[model samples]
Target: MNNQSKQPISPTAHGHRLVVETLNTHPNALRRLHSPGSAENELSELIVHTALHLDTVQKELVDRCTWAAQDLTRVATGTAAPNSLGVLQNSGLQIDLLAARRADAKAHLRSALAAYQRVTTIAKPQHAGPHPPLPSRTSPRTR
Candidate 1:
């Protein structure tokens, strides 16, 4: 007979895993979206728009993570009888990496925003709404 505990996954944990996976896969696709002239065409423009939307969402999540870490640091150090701040101190490496990733996410979002704006400017559609344009040959322009 099996004796292992059949533990259920917490929704928070599941969501975290999903976010991590999405973040992992998005960078490559985002790079492709950023290729020159990608916004000139409709399909590439759509990909860029979708990638931009996804990037914005990812940045928001990364911001939340930074906030949570800040709160954790406070709880670990600000209390009268503070909890083990050692954990945070010991994991300094990971914390630093996370901070770097947060910054990287911000930079990526800025790039995506620029791409979306460029797509809108160059691929102007007849009707008003957010849609990607066709990929066309152009310079890598940014604000």
Candidate 2:
């Protein structure tokens, strides 16, 4: 039998997988409640919004990661303490929970970066300065 049939999936694991999938979805498609200010998107406005979002997401991920690090230290140093939820769970469980949270936050950050890159791609058009005039058709071309 396949691994799926071999064992039952825990709700926590299932939820963690869902969170990862949601975060990995295309940026524009993530929140379907609204469009980028109507179907006709304003490139500059979208870029600004996406950049702001990236910054926020990055900060959130960093914060969450910091928390996770603290938890890791607690687990590693064999210090007994309540997890983020104020539950005195076993160290193993605490570490697993913290890992899942960190993974989700990192996934979100990655998705935000992707969204920013997408919106800013067209924000600026690359143009080589004016090209030299076409070569003189006449044989007497200047050296």
Best by TM-score: 1
RMSD of each: 15.9, 15.9
Report lDDT (Cα) of residue 123, candidate 1.
61
Per-residue alpha-carbon lDDT of candidate 2 for residues 22-131, written as tens digits (9 for 90 to 100):
34323333334235664224432343345344444445545565676777788778895645764434444655665665566555555554554565454558787999
Global fold similarity of model 1 (TM-score): 0.33
TM-score of 2: 0.32
Cα lDDT, all candidates: 0.48, 0.48
In model 1, what are the clashing residue pairs, if there are any?
A: 40-134, 40-135, 40-136, 41-133, 41-134, 41-135, 42-133, 42-134
Model 2, residue pairs in steric clash: none
lDDT for 92 (candidate 2): 47
Candidate 1: list runs displaced more than 4 Å: 1-86, 125-143
Every model's TM-score: 0.33, 0.32
Query: How far in Å is the alpha carbon of 142 misplaced in model 2?
Result: 38
